[model samples]
Target: MSKQYTPREMLEKLISFNTVSERSNLDLIHFVEDYLAGWGVGSILVPDETGKKASLHARIGPETDGGTVLSAHTDVVPVEGQNWSRDPFTAWEADGRLYGRGSADMKGFAATILAKVPDILKANLRKPVHIALSYDEEVGCFGAGPLVQDILSKGPRPDLVIVGEPTNMKVVTGHKGIAVLKTTIRGHPVHSSQLHRGVSAISAAAKLITWLDGKTAENRAGADPECPFEPPYTTLHSGTITGGQAHNITAQHCEFATDIRLLPEEDAESWIRDYRTFIETDVLPDMLAISQDCRIDVAELAYVPGLQEETDGEAEMLVRRLTGDNARNVVVYATEGGIFQHHGLSTVVCGPGSIDQAHQADEFIELVELDKCASFLDDLLEGMSQIDS
Candidate 1:
């Protein structure tokens, strides 16, 4: 017989795997698959193109429509530079909290879901309960798109999705979208003394970065006072930059990465179009004039749609009924909920712990938070069982 593990034990087991975004999560995925199989629940694997990573989805109870999907990502952010007090992958307990790399950010919720699997099976749910474990969520949410597509195509359509992102168990009605972009500028190198004769890639990059900053300031100045987001407007920021070889020579190459977090009402395409137009009309002509080889290229690394507030949304209503949290809530951080919502699934963000602890040194989830989550799942199971098919 398969050994039954409590939620805390399951969490410890999950935290032992070093499934960082840069590393393959196959080990974790395989473990989950084996665990589910031991319980007689079959899972479908959606492997990425490289076969290095995979997403796992399983359904319990009747194969029917109007089901609830519990979604969580298996991968966690890296702990390379952070000054962790102990081994990040090894789970530890102290002061009524469980500490590990992904304890709060996400894996805590996944562990709870896995621990409740036996209860879910025994609930004899009239409606199905789907478990969606995705990969690469920390890095641009790459795995969720394919995972969502696979779920919709292969199985009965679920009525709602609960993305188990750490929200302290509050139901998040909406969240900002994100568009990650990388800009590369190639220019002719020349002596700094004769700078005017050659285009300077670093200078061009600076101009573009300045333009982005100006746009951010413009949005901030005109932001809606009643907006729930902390800054109350869209934000554009350049996170990383690299280029110039030395101070004496005009930079031959320059590259910088930027991300735009847009309010739910905004469209990412509009912003991308505006940025491209600026590059084509205002920035490129001068560089081309100096040398045809001088060029600017903008590549979109990723784009996750904003989760718009649905009027009388099914997912929102269900979570509110379960948690008794009616206060309006939203977040600035992006999540797979937006992608699921974009694909026509009613979605909400709710789970244990706090987002403030995510990706930090010595991350942890309070023991009380785990108990609250377990009670919520128990209530969910009871509710599912009571619903008529």
Candidate 2:
């Protein structure tokens, strides 16, 4: 059970892979599967439909029902538009921080878990420690869905799941949910001079988009003072818009993407229902009166359930005891923890680094964070060694 690569070294190797949400993560998955194989631990892969990417789940130490699941996502956000001081794919250490695309948003945690493999094997315990590495988390927590189902259906059921989502090592018990919406408005096109003869798709889309903005404002106005989340309520906005062909032409098509983040107590489906009703009752009737072919299509591109603060939850207590932090906080962002919690698993979010560093240019996790995580893993190894029944 001798340790192999240090966390930074492993991070360096991991950051070398361009596991962007749009691309395949097979290389990283294979590397981890092989690494675990060398340690005599077999990994179960839950691959996507195309087999281009997969999630890895493995059990270490003794096989028992009440084991720990160390979860992390392998995908990183895109660096196309951002200006980085260094190559985003290259891992460099300076100013006591490691710089890379996934360093903070999570490959750091994944590396530490992988680095701790030898020590975890060395523990020789009654309960086990599970490793879960998923892909496509940046796009919408897409890859984690199958991974969760896999863990629940196959092998030993883990008693606790720790989602390493960069909480700066503080335990996070609740987080917001995200619903990605894509809307397409189809209208009749005509010469701009004859504005009264045909419907303008872009105009209709603008009205709908403005309506969404108003709804967002309404949600914000109704924010709960007691909620721990930043902004204290659900949020909605458009990320991208495109449609018009020319100023002289009445646009026939308009499309835009909306991002909806819901608080744990807010219902995402309810918002969607209201949106659909608006389109049907308010927006669609006017468009249809002008042209029967005019229509609006709204689709949910991705949805990640939100995690709620649980009272006397075992997962929260375990992390609180381990980190020695009695205080609980909620995050404005979403994570796979909610999905696990929704499926009956006690889940908590805790890991090294700050969410502030995630997705930003020159993203990094402080060297001290990695050191603290290493210490945390060591403590976990020792703690699990003496677990009761």
TM-score of each: 0.98, 0.96
lDDT of each: 0.94, 0.90
- Can you write out model 1's per-residue Cα lDDT over 75-170, one digit (the tens) per residue? 999999999999999999999999999999899999999999989988968799999999999999999999999999998899999999999999
Poorest stretch of ten by lDDT in candidate 1:
380-389
- Judged by lDDT, which candidate is best? 1
The regions of model 2 sitting more than 4 angstroms off are 1-3, 387-389
Q: Give candidate 2's error at residue 304 in angstroms.
A: 0.4
- Give me the overall lDDT of model 1: 0.94
For residue 105, give model 1's deviation from the true position in Å: 1.1
**Model 1: how far residue 280 lies from native, Å:** 0.6
Top-scoring candidate (TM-score)? 1
